[model samples]
Target: MLTREWATLPEFAAMALPGVPETRALQKWAISGNWSRPEWRNVYWRRRSGTCGAIEYSYQLLDRPAQLAWMQRHVVISVEDEIAAFGDDKRYADEWRMFHEASQTKQKKALEILQHLDRLHRLMEAGHTLEIAIYDVCREFGLKRTTVMNWRRRVKYVCRHHWLPFLLPGNKGATGPRAACDEQAWEFYRSDYLRAERPNHSDCYRRMVAAAEKNGWVVPSAKTMQRRINELPTAVIKMAREGRDRVKDMVPAQERDRTHLHALQAVNADGHKWDVFVKWPDGTVARPMMVAWQDLYSNMFLSWRVDRSENTDAIQLALGDLVEKWGIPQRAYLDNGRAFASKRMTGGAKTRFRFKVREGDAAGVMTILGIETIFVTPYSGQSKPIERGFRDFAQGLSKHPAFAGAYTGNNPMAKPENYGSSAVPLETFLAVISDGIKEHNSRLGRNTAVCGGVKSFRQVFEESLAQVQPRKPVAQQRHLWLRAAENLTTNKKDGSFKFLGNRYFGSFLNDHLGESIVVRFDPQDLHQDMHVYSMDGRYLGDAPIIEKTGFDTTAAAAEKKRAEKLLTKATKMRLDAEKALSPAELVALMPDLDEDGEDLVESKVVQQFRPRAVVAGSSALALDCDEEQELAREREEMAEVMQLRDYL
Candidate 1:
C-alpha cells in the first residue's frame, strides 16, 4: 500500500477519498470548537502504530479550524498509524487539490447525470418514448442524449423488478444476460443462487451436468431437494449474504432534517427503572421506579410518573397526562411489547385492541388521539425515535461532568445511569434526568436534535421547544412512582404476559387451572406490561398482568414500604374506630364480610394495616385518595383478613 502524509489536516482529507468526512479520528489533539456546533462531539486525536511500522495521526473533527489548531501542537512521542494520503507534500499548488477536487467534480457530475436519468425513468412511467425520455432528461437537466446515456451507464441499470411486462417471446428463464443463453441455460457460476453447490469445488470445473434443469426442470426426490438445501448458506454464509429485503437507513446522523413543531407532531417516550435508595418505613434505602414521556417537538417531558411497581396505571396515567396537556398526538410510536398494546391495557370492558384487527374502544383511543400507535419493528430499533430519546437522555447524564447519577439494568446494554441504584434516593436520579434535559435544551448546539443526535435535528428541536420548558427535573417524582403502582396489574385478553400493576390473571393456569403459578413483568413498561414465559423460559403472551408492572426490586421496595406504612396507619385507625365503641360496634364497623371476621379486628388493632393495593399505589404514583382510604379502613375493621399481603 502507498502512504502519503499531509502537512495539514485539510490537506490530508483533501487526498483521494470517496466520502469526504466518512470518518474523522485522530490522537494527540483535542478541539474546543465554535458554540454553533455540538460540544464534546468528534474532537480529539491520537497517533497509532500501524502494522507496517508506519506512524500516523488521526483527526477527530472536520471543517472546524479551532480543532485544527489543537491537532497542530499535540505531538505523540512514538507510534504507528495508517498513513493518511500517500506521498510527500510535492507541494502541489500546482493549486488544484487534485484527487479531493477531482472526486467532488466526479460526484457532482454523476449526481447531475443521475438526476437526468431519474427524470427519464419517471417519464417512462408516463409512457414517454425513448427519444422523448432522452429529450426529457436533457430538458430537465441541461444534458444531451449521449451525455444522459453515459450517466445512465454510470448507474448500474436497476433490473426491472416486480413484473417486467412481456418476456420478448420465449425469453423465459434468464433474460438479457440469459437472452443469448440457449440450452446452455443450466450453465452456472458464483451467484447468490449458486455461490455454493461447488463452494471450494471451483467453477473452473468443466461440468456438462445440466444446471438444476432450468425453471421447468423439476427435481426428483426429497433427498435431491435436501441436497440442494444442504448446499444453501450455512449460518456464517447466510449471515454474510447482504439482506436485500430491508432498506438500509444509510442516513448519517447529520442528514436528519428538523421540522416545525406542531402539537401532535411527534412524541417520544421511554421507561427507565431506577434502583433508588428510597427511604424505607424502617429508614433503610432501596430502588424504585420511573417512566417518562418526552415531547420530541419541544424536548419537554410531557409527563413522567414513578411507581414502586412501575405498572399499567403509570402508563395509562402518563397518557392521561398527555391527554390533559396536548389532547392527543397524531402518532404514538411504542416499543413492540405489553406497554403499548391495549389488549392488556384496556380499561373499559368494551375496549378491545388487536395488532391484527386493530379495532374497538382500545382502537378508539387511537382514533381519538388521531394517532396510529406503531410498534418499532422487531430488532430494528433506530426505527422508533423515542428509544433515541432515552439514549440521548442517558448520554446527557454520562457526558455531563456535573451529574452524579446511578442505575442498574438486567440487560447490561439496556442499563442507564438513572435506572440503577446508588447510595441516594431515587430523587437524585430524577434530578439527574431533569437536569440533563434542561441542560440539553439550554444547549445552543447540535445535540438539541428533534430525533436526538448530534445533527440538524437538535437545532430545530431547540427552536421549537423555546417556550415549552422541556428542561428541569420533576418535583416529587418518587411520590408519583408509589402512587401509580397500586392498580397497574390486570388481565389482558390474550393473557400472554402480566399487565403493569402486578395484577393476576388465571388463564395462565390454562393447564394448571387449580394450581397457583407465578407471573413476572418488566418494571420499565408501566401500563402493566409484562412478558409471560414459563419457568422453563418459553414465552407466553403478555397478558393477565400481575399488578400493572412486575415485582422488580423497585416495586418490591415500594410494596414493602407501603405495606408497613399502611399497616401503621391502619392500626391507628382501627384503634380509634374501636375506641369508645364496644366489640360489637367494632364488629359492626367491619363488613358482614367473611366468617373468620374476628381476626380482622384484632389484626387491624395490632398492625394498623390497609389493603395492599391502596398502600402500593400510594407508594408509586400517589393513588391515595379519600375513597381509597375510606374503603381500605372499612374493609380493614370487619375483616379477619388473615393479614393477607395483596390488597387491603
Candidate 2:
C-alpha cells in the first residue's frame, strides 16, 4: 500500500527501486500530479484516518490545475499489475454486479478475453517482449494468432475504459446512424394500433408510412415499428385496448384505511345475484340472490342469506344472523337498493326527511338497535366493502364443478356453451354454499390490511374481537327489529285494529279510537302477534287474534271460557264502583212503567238532557199558548202511564 510518507515525497530519487516497474510507475504517476507535497500528504492522511466525508477516489484530491497537469503528464503503470496487487475495489461492487449479470453469451466471451489478458500480464511481468509473450500464451492456450490479437485489443479497451466488455453496448462499432421516424406520426400510429380492436404491426406501419408520405414526412421501416411496439409497456397497452373495467385489476391496488376500525365496529351489507341457475321448490329455475354482511376491518363475512329475490326480509334476516352470532355492529354501511332503502330498513328517523318519505313510522331497525346506518351511493358497488367478498365468493364457490351446466357467466356475452341447459337443485346449491362459506372463512392470506398479522378472515376477526364495543339488542325489542308498514284506522267500538285481515284487540287502544296508528309486523310470518305503536312510536299494547274457529275444539273452548270468566270479574268490579252513586242518580235510572212493562212517555231526567225547543215567533201570548199546549200534551201523554204505573 502507498503510505502518506511516499505520497508526500518530493521525488523518487530518495526511494529508488529501479527493477520494480510497479513501484517506479506509481512514483512517476504521483510526482506528475500538481498537488503540493503537503496537500498530497494531507489527502492521504485524511483517507488513512477515515475522516474524509464520502471521498472515495484518489482523483478527488486534485484541484483544477492539478487535474490538468496530471491529465497532460506522461506516466506509465502496469494497470493489470496494480489491479492484482490491490485486489478489487468494493466501491465498484455495483459495477461488477452489472457485469456478472450481463447476457450469458457476452459474459462468456468477456471472461475468455479477461483470461488471455491475465496470462499476457504475467508474461510481461516476467520480463518478456510483447510478441514473445503473445506467441507463448497463444501456444499454451491453443488459440490462433488473429484471436490473440483480438484478445489483446479487448484487454487494452478494458484498461482504457475501466469497464468490462459485457457492460458495453452489444452492437458497438456496427453500421450507420439508426433509422428515424416522426415522433408525432408514431404517437398517432400507436394510438390506432392499440385500439380495442388492435391492428397488426405491419398494417400500422403501412398506414403510418402512407400518411407520412402524404404529409411529406419521413417514416421508419416495419421492423422498427414492430420493435417500438414491443418496447411499449404491456400493462399500458392492455389498458388502452381492453378497457379499464377489464384491465384495471392488473394494476397494483392500495389498501383501504381501516386504522380506527375494529371487528364489528362497522359492517357492510350488499346483495349479489348468483351466476348459477337453481331449481326452486316451485318447479321453476332461477338465479338466487345472496345478501351478505362483511366486517369492514377484518374482511370477514359475518353472515349471509339466500333467496329467490333480495328484499327487506332477506336483508334483516342476514343482519339478524350477524347480530346473533357476532355481536351487533356499531355502524352499518348499506348499498342503495330498494330493499335496503325500504321503510322497514331505514324508516325510523324522527327528523323531517329530505327525500319523499312516510310519516308516523317508528325508527328504522338499525336506529331501534342503536346501529348507525350509512346509505352508499346508488349503483356504486365499489362504495361498499362487501362487494369484494362477493367477487371472491363467485370465483371460489359459484364456479364449482357441481354447477357446471348451471354456471351462467357474470355477463350475458360471457356465458358458457351449456348455460341454462341444466339446473342445480336448490338443496344442493344451499349445501354447496354452506361449504363454500366455511372454506372462504378459513382460507388464509385474506388479511391484506395486516390487522394483528392474521392470515385468514376468521383469524383476523377473532383477533380483533377484543377491540369491539358492541351495543346489544334487548330481548323484548328483538321482535320489533323489522320495518314498520302502513297505518290503519283503529276501531272506535272495541279499540281493536285490523292487520293482515285479522282483528287484534288491546285494552291500551281504547283511548286511541278512530285514530290512525302504524303497525309493524314480520312479512314472512304474520302469525306472531303484531306490535302496535302510536302515530309517534308510543308502545300500544299487542292485539291477539279475535277469532279462532277452524280445527280448534279444545283450545278455542278453553280460550272462550277464560275470556268469559274475565268479563264476569270485570262486571262485578264495575257494579261495586257504582254503589257510591247518590239516591237521585239511582232514581234517574227508573221511570213510570206501564202494566205491560213499557213507558209511553220520555222520563223527565231524559227530557231535561235534550236540547231546548226553538220557537218560530217570540211574542208573549204565543209563548204562553205554546207553554200551555206543551203542558196539556205532557198531561195527556202521562195520564195513561200514571194510571198504569202504580209503583211510581
Candidate 3:
C-alpha cells in the first residue's frame, strides 16, 4: 500500500509533526507558514470528498525530515481501515439508534463480534482459507465457530460501517410481551387505585376481581395492578393520595433578596406560642405566646414580648419596644392576624382585609409613623423571616433544662413523656426566652445567607447599621406605638373626661368641652398623661391624670386654696379692666340731644291712644298736709324701686 499524498489535519498532525501532536497547534503552524497558499511549492489544500467536507493537505507541507518520517511510519491500508475511518459518518441512522437502544450486554457482545470479524478478515487477506480464518478468529475470541459464522451471515449484505446493530444478539424487531390485562381490566384497576381515597393495591385488586366476576370482565393479578400503579407519574400519585395543599408544598418557596435592605430599614413581625407550659401570675397554666419583630436584612430579633395570649396590646408593645430600641422601620412585613390587623396597628392600611375599614377610622401606628405595612399571606410561615427564628427558639428554649417537665410538645401528638407534669412560672419562662433570644441573635457561625456562616445576626445588623441611617421617631411620637386610641367627649362641666376609672383634665381641654376627641393613652399605665387629639386627628395636648385625694387632707385643702386663688385672680383682672372705663366718662361719651329737646331718631310707625273712662259719680279729693306728705313719700319709694330694677 502506498502512503496517501493528501491527509486531513488530524492525520498530518499525528503522522508528520513530532513535537506538536495536536491538530490545532499544527493548523496554527501551517497557517503561519502559508502552506495552504496556491503559490506554495511543497503543499496545497483541497476539500476532501466526503459528507464532512473537511480540508486535507499534501504530505509535502512538512519538511523533508518529517516527510521521510511519515513515509517510514506508514502501512498498507486495507478496506477495513477505510471503512473504520468513515464508520461514524457512513452508519445508518436507524442502525445507530438500534445499537444505542440495545442492552449493555448485547452491545458488548456485538463489539466483541466486530473485533473478531476484523481479525478474521485480516487472516483471509493474508492468504488463509475462510474456514481456517473463521476457526482461528472464533478460538481467539473464546467464541464458537458457528456463532462467528452466524454473525457474519447476519451482516453479509449489510454495509460494514452499519453492522453493529446486526451483530447485536437479539431479535431486532421484537418488542416484549403484550399487556397481560385487557383494556377493561386496566381501566377498572386504574380508576380504582388512582383515587383520592388512596386505596391499597391489594384491596383495589380484590375489588376489581369481584367487579370482574359480576361484570364478566377479565381480572388482572395483584402484581400486574401494582406495576400499573407504579407506572403513574409521581406528581399524579401525590396529588391523588395527598391533598392539593401537599402538592403545593412541593413547589419551591420564593427566595427574597434582602441584601439591598439595611438594618431597621425593613422588619418582619410574627407571634409564636412556646411548647412549654407556663404558669401565669393568676395561677393559670398555658403556653406563652411570644410576639417578636426581626430585622429582615440580618435575621436578628430586635424586640420581643411574651404574653399570656396573643393580643393587640402585646403586639403593640412589642412593636413599641422594637421602635424604641432600633428606631422606626421603613417597612413592616406583617401577617393578617387579629392582633396585627387591629385598628391600633394597621387600621387605615388599604391592604388590611381582615376587618371592615371605614373612612372615619383614625390613622393606625403604621400609618401615623409613615411605615409601609406589607401584609403577608395568612398562616404562611415562609412569608415572615421571624417565623424561622421562632422555629429555632422552639427547639432551643422549649427544650431547655429549666423547662424540663414543663415541655409541652409543639403538637398534641408530639407531647413528651412528662408532658403537663409541671409548669414553669411565667417569670422563669420569660427569663429563659430572653436568654434564648439573645443567644439566637449573638450565636456565632450562623449560616444564613446574610450571615455567611461566619458572623452572628447582631454582628451583621450592627455592621449594616453603621452604613445606613434608619428613620427614628421623636419623643412626642412615642404615643403612636405605646398608646391605644379611643374617641371620647370631654365632660360637659370643666371639660373633664372619665377613662379607665380615672378622670383626665387639662386647661387646653376646656376649649374642646363637650366635643368628641381622640384620646391616646397607655393602657398599661392609665395614670400617665393621655395624649389628646381632635376629632380630625390633630394632636392637642396631654391631659395629666387627676389623682383622687381625701377631702379632709391638707393636700386637698391646698389644692382647693390654689383653685380659689386662681378664680379670684381671674375675676379681679376682669373687674379691673371693666372699671378702667368709668360710668360718668362713658355717659359723657354719648351723643348730645337735639336742640328742640326731641330725639333725632323717630319711630317709623305711629298709633292713636284711647281715652280712659272714669267711674260714674267719681269726685276729685284734696289731702291735708300730713296726708299729702305720706302720699309723696310713697311715690318717691316707688320711683326708687323702678330705678333699682333697671340697674339690676
Candidate 4:
C-alpha cells in the first residue's frame, strides 16, 4: 500500500492501489508519515518511507480487495503474513469486520482475526477458558494465524476482572445481581452451589459458602466463576430471566414436598361463616367469620376465631390466638382467598414477592409472628380440606334441628354513647360462634349413620387426634378444641350444678349455685376454674336464671317445653329456607323427644345408631351407603319400575 500523507486524495488512492513502496515504485520517497493511532492496528499499514522514517497508511475498506489481490499475485510480502505484525492484540469492538468482503489474503486474514477476537471477548467473560474454546472454533470455522494471536491475548487476561473471558460480567458501571453478591466468590456461585431451593436457591447458596469454610472444600474464585457463567448459551440467559420470574411468582411460598405434613408439618386454615344467629353489635344480622387452624397429624383444630370481618386484623388475631395457645406451627396452608392467603405469610412475604410485599402495618404484624404461610390454587377449595371441614361444621350449625332464634338487631354497641356501657358487639358474636361450634361438632351427623357409619367430622377429628397423640388428656384435648382459658372447669356443689365442684374457682359465683348462677366452665382447662363473662364483657353477677318450676320435672311439662322449642326451631327453619320448603310443612313438625323428654335429632339418631356392619365399606359402584347415593339409586330404580309399567 502507498503512503497517504504526501499524496493528494487521488494520489493516496494511487499509492494504496499498488503495494510497491514509494521508493521502489516511483524511485523516490513520496508520501509523508503514518496514520496516527498505532494503538489502532491492522487498519494502518506501514512501510519505511526513507532513512528518516516509515510512512503508514490504510486501505479504505471499500476499495481494498483489488489492491490486496494485486499484491498477492505479485508476491509483494504475503498478504496473509502481514497481520501478525501486531502480535496478540485485536481490538474488541473494532469496525474491521468489513474486511470479510476482501478477496485477497490481507483482507481475508484481517476479517478472520476480528471475528476471532469477538469470540474470545465473549468466552473470556466468565474469567476461565476451556481448551475447547480454541478447538471448537477451529473445528467449526477453521482458525487462522490472526485468530491465534487474538486467543493468546485472551489467555493473558484469563484471570482478569470478574468471571474470565470478559471484564467483570456487565462492565464495572453497575452492581451485581444484588448488593449481597459483592464478594467475588459469591459472584461466581450458581444454583450448582445448592441442590434444592426449599430454603431456596439463595438461601442454599448462603449456606453452601458457610459450609465450605467449615468443611474445607476447594472453592473457585467467584470472579472467575462469574466469567464462566457469562459464556453460557443464550438459552441459559433466557432461563435466568424466566427463572427469576418463576421465583417471583413463587415468593411468599417456595415449592415443597407434598408429604411434609406432620404434627406440625403444616396447619390447614380457612375462613367460615359462623352459624349462630345473633344481632351483631352493629345491629347487622352478620355471619361472623370462623377462622380455624387444624393440625395435620391430629386433625384437631388447634385454634379458632369468631369475628365479624376476616380482614388482616382478624387474621392476625387468629394467628396470635394459635401461637399464644398451642405454640407456633412450622407452616400454614390456606387457599388463595384474600383473607388467609398472603405471599408475606411464607418465606418472609417480602422475600417471596421478591420485595414487592413491603413492610406495611398488617404485614409487620404477621412478620413479627414468624409463621411460614402458603396459599393453594385459587378456586380449588378441595385443596384446603381443613377449611372444608370448618365449612361443613359451620354450615351444619345453621341447619341443625335444634337451633332456633332470629337475631333481633342485637348490637349492644347501638348505645355507642358509652363503648363500655354498650354491649361489646363482638361479645354477642363470640357467644353465638362459641356455642354453635360446640353444638355442631358435638351433634351426631345426620348422614354419618350410613355415610360415615357414625363417623362425624368431630368424630373423625377426635379419632385422628387420638391417633396422633395416643394418650392426650381431656384437658389437652379441650385446649386443642376450645382454646386458651376455656379448657378448665369448676365442680357443681351444694345443690348446684358446679364447675367441676370447685367453689369460687373459675368465675365469681353468685352467692349460691343451685339457686341459679349462670354456670361457666373452661372447656379448655377443665383441670382449673373457668373464667366467666356475662352477656357482655362484664365480670359481674353471672347467676344463671333458674327454671321457674313447681316441684315437678314432669313428663307433660317437659313435653310442653319440647313442643315449644321444636315449634320455635321449625318456624326459623321455615323462614330461613323460605326458598325451599313450605311454611305449613315446617310448622307441622317438632323436635322428636324420647320418653325421658330429651331433645333428639330423630332422623340423625335413627340413621347413626344403625349397625356399621350393615353398611360396611360403601362405594358408588356398590351403592352401600344410605350414603345419599344409595337412596338416590333406589329412587331411580323405583322410577325405572314405574316407567316400564307405563307400557302396561
Every model's TM-score:
0.32, 0.54, 0.63, 0.26
User: Which scores better on lDDT, 2 or 3?
Assistant: 3
Model 1: per-residue Cα lDDT over 162-261, one tens digit each: 1111111121222233112223323342242344333432222223123545444332343333333344434434433434332243334334443466
Full-model lDDT, candidate 3: 0.78
lDDT of 1: 0.43
**lDDT winner between candidates 1 and 4:** 4
Query: Which parts of model 3 have CA positions greater than 4 angstroms off?
Result: 1-191, 223-236, 489-504, 513-515, 524-529, 544-648
What is the Cα-based lDDT of residue 120 in candidate 4? 43
Candidate lDDT (C-alpha), each? 0.43, 0.68, 0.78, 0.45
Model 4 TM-score, all chains together:
0.26
RMSD of each: 30.4, 14.2, 11.9, 29.5
- Backbone clash count, each prediction separately: 92, 3, 0, 58
Sort by TM-score, best first. Answer: 3, 2, 1, 4
Output the lDDT of residue 142, model 4: 62
Residue 156 in model 2: lDDT = 51
lDDT-best of 2 and 4: 2
lDDT of 2 by residue, 1-648 (tens): 112122322232233323222546545654576443665445442333444542222432433233222322322333243345436655444444455456777766665555555555645654567887677667656778886665455445343234344233342321235688888788868988999887777787788888888887777878777867766766778877787765756756655688567888888888899999999999999999998898888778888999999987888888878877777788888766678877666776443233467555545667666788887666655677678788887786889998989999889899999989899999999999988888887887664764445488888778789666666666655555553455788998767888778887776776788888767776776667678876655567676667757653666766766876886798778778978877898788888556887657865664336677877665655566778889999999898678535522
